[model samples]
Target: MLDTTKYEETTISTTPACQEDPTGVNYRGNLSRTIQDQTCQAWTSQDPYQHTKTPANYPNAGLDNNYCRNLDMRFTAWCFTTNPGTRWDFCAVGYLDPKCQATPACQEDPTGVNYRGNLSQTINNHTCQAWTSQDPHEHANTPADFPNAGLDENYCRNPNIENTAWCYTTDPETRWEYCAVGYLDPRCQATPACQEDPTGVHYRGLLSRTIGDHTCQAWTSQDPNQHTKTPANYPNAGLDNNYCRNPDGVNTAWCYTTNPETRWEYCAVGYLDPRCQGSVV
Candidate 1:
């Protein structure tokens, strides 16, 4: 049960800000009104609209004072309508013009030939050396030489047909290194264009809890439970952290439970689609 008294202590008078990202997943605004000009219900309140999304469960999702939020990591900010007839609707918030926003980078770049994003750091968190400079690690990949390669400033670029997006780093010992530039576009949040994970073996998202609300144990840890599922055991499984994954071909993604009694449990990592209305059930 939620402490409804917390709602009484809150107040929101300012209008919400416009969404900044391509998708409103980054929207941290307080837009309490719906597109139909209907007031939104408090996230903690289930009087007219019964919702599973609450501040208690999603503390970092910006659920405050009945303001609009995307606690479920959806493509847009939304809220339950106070109107008993309506369940919920997308907020009437404005989005930043595409021209004004920087182009999002792709997560995967098999070759550094097509990369144009502004990633100025290497995999070792080293700042990139300027292409214009002839410092410790000098190279001929410059904006003046290869003008079409998009070599600008110290940003990581693929001047040649390299393996992946790499840059000349500031570290003298480690002259150049590759980068793991993640996808900024929300549409690429899931596989098959944001659809459900068919087998859960390919699931790589950061869901770290079990369906029973127990915290997942680290893949490298064997304190509460000793398990063979680990990065060393399955290098292809991407088992770095406690995030849910199915390396042994289970029905869905599951994790080794932190509880000593319960060895493992399936995670409620539902359909990857941001707009999906279905659950694991």
Candidate 2:
């Protein structure tokens, strides 16, 4: 016996959509291997969305490979094709299209630890309720951890460390204590710690608070007596004063040392304040 249903012919229909940008060129990958891609490459490499660049030709670029399934390090969405019926349909997210493909969840970490990485993150949002992850170190924008203020001579500071505070910036020229906000905030506002100048910071070694891009030099601990003014220990024997601080107390107090920096050096800690005592007292 033959079933008539087997002979019934069915028409295949595929839903098509206009190629639109869910995220701009910034969030898009290279063009979908087309003449437009070659045309874009021939233009300028500086801006992806230059004159010759066509958004419709390329697939979306993103920090994350997930196409609306997983959140980025900043809780933002990546991939996310605008074309609904296309092969690159957003998975896991189901149907409702996200407005911004590269926006972070509008949420904040309840524990201050999370704040160390996302200071600029928003607080209390419905869309961002599900996102929560972080990088290893701290972010320097929140008001949670009251970063300890390190003196010019202090080094090896970390937010994870029990007693240490955020290692603020030091003026290479003036050698004054200042926060990332650019002030003499001995009590740095509780915020994410910046690793840019992780080592050499304001009011640190030499004490002058001038802006020069220099990575901070890490040491075992901030000990004044430990770092003696020896030829080997001091950075530049003829150039800068390489000595442990005086007084030996933690937090900006220079330890006892004989080789103080020059007295008139405006940027030196001892030069800014008499207590630093540029010369061995």
Candidate 3:
């Protein structure tokens, strides 16, 4: 028996036919016309898997994904991984790659020197006239030869120039002359006692003896009974009378009127009399 379904290699088409036309010939043209036509129809009816699976041609594939997204790529990825907001583009750019737009590139003075931030006159060329900070006395116009006039003792004594008594001169002669005779001159209001004459009679020793005719005097005779004439020159003379009377009262009063010149007279207590008589017998 002859097999009508026998396998024939020539019946199948190796080249795919055009999907748009069923009667189109396959590119190899080795298949039966019917098989070619049916293959073309089937290919036209089915959706192509390659067209869906293959990626499209993109113009900027090499660039980072976040380049057009307004955020740094690394920061975006970090935010995504850390569960942060993806909308914070500026913050992301600051965190990943900070731009110098907000922050200045340099902090220097007009001369391109680094600023020390202080306003010193010595370093900044600021004169006392231009700025008061340079002034040692805070802009006071004190003269260059201004007198200090510190603690003048003469000025303390006399304060006014018109008075002609101010003692502000620095001359040594003037200073000595002003202070001279301050102790001895009674006009000096503050003179000290020790500065007066030390050996003068005003400061002599104390008087020890009483002054009177009864003042003790020495006679030439040693015996108390001997009659001695009063010294011809007595310091303060009184009646010249002498009497021998026992001051101890051991003997009775005696009167010897042998001669008026030889008579012995006893002077009364506190009196100098020239008469002597026996106890008024």
Candidate 4:
């Protein structure tokens, strides 16, 4: 739970001028650049939101503890809102005459450093940023040309990642890529997207935790519309049955459902989720 005292700045101070560092140095009005003890790495975005490369003469020192000292959610736009078209930059500088008044007199980053453009995650009760190196087009690690290996039963293991005819393929890295949320690769365990194999089974996605005696798609988390899980990943969801898809979605192949009767209406055909006893009931 959020401490109301801290949110209101009653226990803390908002005036950057009144802020202080660990060494007892008062930071009054010298907020232009990073000062070892005074300036914080995480803060409200600059008045004129800047992204891509760090800009010189950038205004706004940012909030101290990544806290929303002042939130004007009434407006359609917000400081925390990100725009991926511009690499998840914050709201335009003059959009809402934006201002993120953060609470707490102390700085979030003592050293005052962070990767300029990266996604943040909660780590050890602190917001930790990470590489946003996103490659949505799946344009890497593809072979230009190769002779097919003889057909075999142990081939095409990762058809989801690499959709090539693996039975005749010849290589261990056929469909190698980063792991997904519920299907973390045992070989690539160090990635950020990797999830623990909770069910002592692989390839179940979130279904790794078996419901009765089965895996992913056997039992879903929620209506697919609100989540990102899709039939491509959870093929066991049944032929054209989108119930196992991500939540909040409407007609997308991702898991979705307005109600029980129409659950499989929009699902892709020829795809039978493993849970339907090989087909729908």
Tell me, by lDDT, which candidate is best. Answer: 1
Residue 239 deviation, candidate 4, in Å?
Answer: 12
> What would the per-residue lDDT of candidate 2 be over residues 32-124, giving only the tens digit for each residue?
221111121222122322322223332232322222321221112223333332222112111112221122221221212222221121110
> What lDDT tens digits, residue by residue, belong to model 1 across residues 1-281?
99866565542211122222323555666678865566899998997967688888888877767987756533246788889875775564422222322332444444656766555655434668988887978899888999988877887777876656678988796688765443423322433322446547777865665654466898989879997988999999979988888888877788998888889987644332222332322
- Which candidate, 1 or 4, has the higher lDDT? 1
Error of 1 at 192 (Å): 3.4
What is the per-residue lDDT of model 4 for residues 1-281, given as tens digits with 9 covering 90 to 100? 76687677743443222121211112122222111111222344542334221223223322343322212111111122232221111121111111212321113321112111111111001121111211222322222222122111222222222321112112222222221111221111221111222111222232121111111232234543234354455455442331223333242223234444433332211122211212222
- Candidate 3 has a TM-score of 0.10
For model 2, the run of ten residues with the poorest summed lDDT: 123-132
**Model 3 CA deviation exceeding 4 Å by range:** 1-86, 91-103, 106-281
After TM-score superposition, the amount by which residue 71's alpha carbon in candidate 2 deviates from its true location, in angstroms, is: 30
Task: Mark the regions of model 2 whose C-alpha exceeds 4 Å error after superposition.
Answer: 1-132, 138-184, 187-211, 216-268, 272-281
lDDT of 2 at 7: 43
Model 3: lDDT equals 0.20
Residue 275's C-alpha lDDT in candidate 3? 11
* 10 residues in a row with least lDDT, candidate 4: 115-124
What lDDT does candidate 1 reach at residue 171? 78
In model 4, which regions exceed 4 Å deviation? 1-147, 157-161, 164-184, 192-211, 215-281
Taking all chains together, the TM-score of candidate 1 against the true structure is 0.38
